[model samples]
Target: MSGQAQSPAKPPPELSTSDASGTVSAVAGTLNGLPEDPQMTPLAPPRSTPPSKIPLRPRKIQKLSSDNLKPSMTNLSASAPKPPSSKKNRADARRSSSDALAVVIPRVAARSLSCEGEVETALRHLCAVDPLLVPLIEVHPPPNFDTFHSPFLALTKSILYQQLAYKAGTSIYSRFVALCGGEHGVVPEAVLSLNPQQLRQIGISGRKASYLHDLARKYQNGILSDSSIVNMDDKSLFTMLTMVNGIGSWSVHMFMIFSLHRPDVLPINDLGVRKGVQMLYGLEELPKPSQMDHLCEKWRPYRSVASWYLWRLSEAKGGPSGVASAMAATGVSVQHHQHQLQQPLPPPTEEQQQQLVDPINSILNLGYSEFHFSS
Candidate 1:
């Protein structure tokens, strides 16, 4: 893969369509003993909402996804200090038995990867090199990558997640999702429900509310759309998207992954990507974007796929912040991007107890030291 400069002019060529509807299915525990898919869209948010953000409704606790925290790190364990063993903890447990954000298998839709012909040549070679990455070709095949939604909503969520822990972003997203619909999908009218104040009440920061409203209004009017995006290349998409409030290249990078599903998005600036690169390539500092472009060169068409795995690998190695947020301010998924805060620890195991930057500690609001489990 050639490490071209990160130019807004460089466009990612399209990928040919491949059908792969075969999903690895599994059951998830639920809010009321009923199975639920977390990716399921929520009912539409009320239309004509006040521009002033509305306050979020009282939240209900639901069971979380087992996948929220991967099982590979079983050696590590730290319990949320058993809350006061009083009625509070008991009620807490009961109420939490049905929190709104329960675990659900992400319902991935079939999407076609369309790009210029030349890019495909580079992408195919990259896929051949890694057997593990072969799954991305099969699982996320072209069709599985198409996203049909407002680019702005996805970008806003990404912004909200910047530097934040997964749980933190999830909390904010749940509220935002509630605004759009009930819990999972965004509805234009639902977002139009309240004035900005009502949006702020839902826990969206003042700036983010403006971004969402702009996104909604544009989406409502069709300024944001697949047809509009399809003709434009990646650079164009980035340029068009960043026009909204609170959006940046990093946020746009995330949008490429989840929304545009653009193949080959290299978020060299992303902390998680940097950390993962360090772990994989044995670098002292995150390889600079120039260096990263060279390293990721082989992952070409499947670079996005490879990047996704690299992120999972980082999570497994112990930071465990993948896909959730811990801190609230940055809203960036602390685990989503990788940055080495301190020198990487000499590898440690469960009994040894490494406080290897676990976001769960902060996200769950726990004071964690090492892993401990008591039967």
Candidate 2:
């Protein structure tokens, strides 16, 4: 390489000027004692060339843009896509919702006139807590003015169903009806003439047997006739019915609704009702009676209707639902459902068959047995 000396002073103007010639001239000019124009010079020999990166393997590019492809709603590491919550993604949602409103509008129009305001407020609260429950309750109504009838036997049947499931209770009740006069099972004389020991023998638990007898005695004695219960307020009536043995607050609530047909009764203590609430609320723990009561307070006079809706919701529940499976994704055990009764009674045996066929009334001297159905 030809060595070019670094200039210590500015080049003269003639030397600094570029002429038509292409030759590059190095010269020196000075400011004070220092060079004004810096001449370009080589410092040190060049280092080796920059190392090239290993060429990347070419990837296939997707031709479709985002709009052409279904949008993914999953977490980065997860393969499963979540449900879309976007409005555009939910196009049919508005139509389904409006049709739902159409169904709801007529129902509100058809509600009990006196309790309309309370029903509105309570249902508003209920829908807020559980959007699904509203439609169920709207379709299924609870006991009301038209459902109740004044009779000992009808009310007794409803009480027998207490804490029992719909199907089991229906089966047991059918057997009980056949035991009682069947079709004509509930007259004053039919129950008054029933042998307490005989009724107890027909699969009626000891406590329930006593309850029936006490109820029979009171009805016969005029202590609590149909009128007496109908006129009594909710609290008084519940207390009066609960006075009977084996009949807890639950039974009394049933009696009030099905028999007395009282409005505003809340069966907060019922396991089914509470289970429904727990399921709807998606709770980790089942709520206590106090918590159920506090939550149910908004239901007020329409609590029975709210309860019916909740029961319907409970019926609609699937085992280990999507939410449950999601919760289980974290490897936690989530109790999916709660059964009302343990080890349900088995279907038909000789004892049950005999009880069903037995006479409601006895011969003049003996209790209801040894009597056969007339052809």
How well does each candidate superpose onto the true structure, as a TM-score? 0.46, 0.46
TM-score of 1: 0.46
Expressed as tens digits, the lDDT of each residue in 82-179 for candidate 1 is 45488878888877765644545342222324334423443455566755545434433222232244443445455555444455656776777766
Cα lDDT, model 1, residue 182: 57
lDDT of 2 by residue, 175-240 (tens): 677877683566565765667576666655566666677777777877776666656778887787
Worst 10-residue lDDT window, candidate 1 = 17-26
RMSD of each: 48.7, 24.5
In model 2, which runs have C-alpha deviations exceeding 4 angstroms? 1-146, 159-185, 200-207, 318-375
Candidate 1 Cα lDDT to native: 0.53
